[model samples]
Target: MDTFWKDLEAAAEARDADALTELMRAAAHDGGNGEPLGIRYDAARSARNNVDKYAEN
Candidate 1:
């Protein structure tokens, strides 16, 4: 894995929720407002599912 992706994977594996959240925000920033990279739910099913709730609230 490239340094960036490797770091991301490492953060996810550590169960570092805040780190993963920051990573998502960074990706969205780098990808720009239009075609931004979305969330990465690498840990659990609830993680994937809670995403929409985040947007809605």
Candidate 2:
């Protein structure tokens, strides 16, 4: 398995929404997107629903 997290983190820190979206989608297709991208996804979803979590930001 190849790791592309460096690319993802750099993209995230830059706040590159397009890159972030693409990275998340790619990870999803690669079968592990949920854990990584879902951290933020679930966070956003939780915020919208008033659910709280201790998930990393």
Candidate 3:
């Protein structure tokens, strides 16, 4: 796989929302499309929600 995908996978595995967001922004910028940005926003939101849910347990 490409480095870009590797980095994304790493961030996801690490649960690093900030890193994921940054990568998504970069991807969206390069692609000139809103899809990546939307994905990034969702990923960050999901990560935060996951953390919050875990904390409630």
lDDT of each: 0.50, 0.50, 0.60
Q: Which regions of candidate 2 deviate over 4 angstroms?
A: 1-3, 33-57
Mind giving the per-residue lDDT tens digits that candidate 3 earns over 1-57? 235556766776776767866775666555424354456545545655665566579
The pairs that clash in candidate 1 are none
- Return the TM-score for candidate 1, rounded to 2 decimals: 0.49
Error of 3 at 48 (Å): 8.3
Please tell me which predicted candidate would have the highest lDDT against the true structure: 3
Return the candidate ranking by lDDT, descending.
3, 1, 2
The model with the greatest TM-score is: 3
TM-score of every prediction relative to native: 0.49, 0.49, 0.51
Considering summed lDDT, which 10 consecutive residues are worst modelled in model 1? 39-48
Q: How many clashing pairs does model 2 include?
A: 0
Candidate 1 C-alpha lDDT tens digits along 1-57: 224466566665565556667666566555333433453323322342355456568
Candidate 1 regions with alpha-carbon error over 4 angstroms:
32-57
